[model samples]
Target: MNAIGIDELRGLAMLPPTASGHSPFAEPCLLLRLGGTAERRLADWLRQLPCPVIGIGEADAPLAASCDVVVQNEQEAQPLLAGVRRSPVAATVLVQLLRASESLPVADALTMESLAYATLQGGAEFRRWLEGRPAPPVPPAETGPAVLLAREADTLRLTLNRPARRNSMSVEMRDALVEALQLALADDDIRRVRIDGAGKCFSTGGELDEFGTAPDPATAHAVRSLTVPGRLLAACADRAEARVHGACIGSGIEFPAFAGRIVAAPDAWFQLPELQFGLIPGAGGCVSLPRRIGRQRTACMVLGGKRIDARTAKDWGLVDAIESSR
Candidate 1:
């Protein structure tokens, strides 16, 4: 992908807005040439343009704050813009970043920007894959308990137990998790709550077979907002810890991020592939991930569709510690 030049960027800004209020450039990205001083009018225009703007040149705190991304020079801007231009939803993600910036904290704005990009990129890829592809057969729902409970001393240990599906977070699993958290919260004797998963991998995220099976978007939203364990874990974060191993995808990483401490095995790897399905991180990842690593890195992980190893996860402050695999 070619780096968007200054002249091209200016032309894009001059173009008429779409009926839905978006830029003309299908993959709009602004390369702002910021010298020593802050350009207020330029900044205002950049903000209004529906695309991610990268301010290249001298560092100006105020000016930097206004732009979605800032770099030292054209060289730095090239790779970043190349990556952005490759995303099918680059323009849409920029628009979302601008809106999120207005009301959210700086960290949150960055996080949202990354998520928006990831969502669009993922969604587009998913659609492409679906084209001419036969619908996959849905597996029969697993029976028996989805969560296993064990008491040790003053700690309540909850293990996700559907190994057949690699402990995918089925609705039953989510409900069971919430129930166990509630139980632990109610008992003063339970001073701590430990969460882990059974089988080869911790989890592969929410049940793929169950996607779009919800009666309606509103109902799904209600279940996610009201009943998901992400919220419960957050409320009692200080008393909660997660021991994660193997692949921790999407909600697997999102939920554990809320725990006061997250311990990852040496072989553990993390990813957020929700956007690949044309969706945001619905499992409180929008909140938890950004809080842990800041938005820029989160965006890279989500938008790049990259898997982060335990070492990288630790360096980014996503996991509190990494333990040697047994």
Candidate 2:
């Protein structure tokens, strides 16, 4: 929660490193603004800092690489700081977030470790709040399909059909996804499974009103583990591709992270807002996202509730490619 000015940051870098090879302020999250000549000159020292540093303004490649987060403007830094302060394990969370900024090779085993850590350290109040909300009203069967399934040669296309709701992942949508994926798994002729959303967005995340509908946490955990579309996508990752556009939020981005190929439109943006709601990503994001971009970046996204643009997502290895929206 400490906001250090650029001058102070520069001074700290010049001081002697501790026996542990970390700066004196290394234990606390440091926030600062850097640009122009100063940023370039201090790039090496900035990279060597052992603490989490949130930088505002344009940074050279070396400095940018060293920064735990680089926001284009000062306003964006506020929410990230707020998110960190709200967490019970702020230092640990910040360290994880900072580690994500580092260049690390992706490994399945490492991703699993990240998932375990996320689940174990997630806020209990967030869980209780999410599970205490009112259940959502059921959509009528006559409302047409929440998910539309079709075939085109070897490819099976699944479109989220509820444009009015921005294709929120309602119960009906989840069921439809499960069924379509199950069919795709059984059919030998279905060589590819392509997922897309109708209207403006890929999705606005899970329907908020539906939180806490499950009778108990145990049942909810079972459903999330055994029947969520994220699991289905993970099972057939090699054959699955998600063409995402617009705002891909919460479950929107989490589910697609499990796919082998994610083709995002130029205008697409990704975000994880679950932490703002006082909960971790409940829709398999902790597992799927860390697997794609490494746990550190995943931690940054979740803990900071930051919006990552399509280009950033591609650069971080979250999406395979960026293409025009169809």
Candidate 3:
């Protein structure tokens, strides 16, 4: 890995995209250390590069967008840089694809993510991880509703009901969530939809057992496009309020993020851990979170598998505010 200043980066950007075997874009990651402010226009050029950009210090507002992710100093960046080196293809390709989809429509962005995630799923990295971990367990049929719905006069309250599973987003849960959100979309009479969960955590993530069961990458992509509850939650975003508690992870945070307002309990923490399994945020997180916080911060979480506690989440605009424990 190499670190470059603003002036050198501008010069490097002038090179043609296919400028021989020495193209800067061919590297796994690059550290950008800007002593002062940078030209906002440079962000456009930076995004076009296929490599991951790590903003080092004093990134300033304008230059922050150009960084795929950032750290205040070099010491904090070692693990991230090492991760990029270990899985260079996933690190570089995932951010490149994420930046490309940042400005797209919600549905289109999700479809792009689904396709990319599926591609990664069938790749060597995911296979490598899968071979090492225990095979995901299969659970019996749901004996109860995954989501509990109750009408409170003008408001409809939806609760994630799978405490035993820590509210893992099973197929039943996704279907139930979509149907509930659709009601909000169809009826003007429903003034508000309050969504929360019933367990120690909102949801851990997607059902693990189902991870390797999809017949093929294409089929998985198609299924994700059809059943993604995040898209439906986005459709009713205006009327939705997600009150989350405990762990808001993977689909846990991915689903709630689409809500117009998200209030977090004191213990709430957010994370996106799909990358460890060589998958990207297949759940609309790439689209929704970047829209909420910004492209760089969202990339930081997904790429680094970092956790954001409630206070940090609020400060970063990942959540609307932190609420009292009550």
Candidate 4:
């Protein structure tokens, strides 16, 4: 389509300008467009407009809800983001497309209102569009040794090796951890599993990068893998050890809480901010955390979404030992 053909986008308008001398972008539209000449033309138009136009770059589409216009096109869909540095667009809308041209005006594509509902309003309107999209499965590459392995006849040492992404638990890491835990559980020679991080923080909890793109079925599968192993680990809750520091949040706290003993540095802070993300403790934490700290305290910690110092964690019956290294 020609760059001038983009004027048709005016027909997809959802909001009218509140005042004269105002361009629609002043009342901005979250624009979703495939990267190409058309996208560049739209971007140029948006730049000249009198308001905020949110440009959703191809990769940052998850944050598209905050924008007003979303454009999709193949010609401008290249990953090499341009005009992004040039627009007053509140955000850009980029749909994942292959072969660049697939992003061209297709009859079977998302609508502006639907985009607003699914992304801007954070509703399920995009669920149908997302139904078939899923990350291809990894080849089960060996990421590291089993998290729990017998170092001595009576002692097991478990280390989370993903120090790069703040030790965020990827699907691969979760699976590896599960396999490690299973091996540890089956070994008659092992007595205690000592869990610690390889770097600064113990863990930042679940990986959210895959949130919108992860198909519900795969997400469910991942959830089962993450929590089932967590349940099993919690079940083997005898004389386990946790050496933690830095920000321990959500599943981080949930996982460490399951240890028979939790050792936190004096500077360590524990928190559960799942409520902020519209989720509950999925790692058997609703039962496990409450069992340790009581339902009232669990509610306080989760609902409050506040930092719980080491002393507070100890006082709430959440932690067992405070490390001296802080």
Per-residue error for 239 in candidate 4, Å, reads 3.2
RMSD of 3: 2.6
**Runs off by more than 4 Å, candidate 1:** 1-25, 28-37, 40-49, 52-134, 137-143
The best candidate by TM-score is 3
Highest lDDT, which number? 3
- Overlapping backbone residue pairs in candidate 1 total 1
Reference-based TM-score of each model: 0.75, 0.68, 0.91, 0.54
Q: Write the per-residue lDDT of candidate 2 for residues 238-261, one digit (tens) a residue.
A: 999999999999999988888899
lDDT of 2 at 127: 68
Each candidate: RMSD: 5.1, 6.3, 2.6, 17.2
Stretches off by above 4 angstroms in model 2 are 2-78, 89-124, 127-142
Worst 10 residues of 4 by lDDT: 90-99
28-134 in candidate 1: lDDT tens per residue? 56556654444466456656666566666554544565566666777766655545555436434534554455457534443454445334433554455335346
Q: How many clashing residue pairs appear in each of the predictions shown?
A: 1, 3, 0, 39
Error of 1 at 235 (Å): 0.3
Clashing pairs in 1: 122-276
lDDT of 4 by residue, 1-106 (tens): 1222233444333234333233324432223442333433333333334433333344335322222223354333222122222221212222111111123322
Supply the global lDDT for candidate 2.
Answer: 0.71
The 0-to-1 C-alpha lDDT of every candidate, in the order given, reads 0.69, 0.71, 0.81, 0.51
The pairs that clash in candidate 2 are: 100-296, 100-297, 126-278
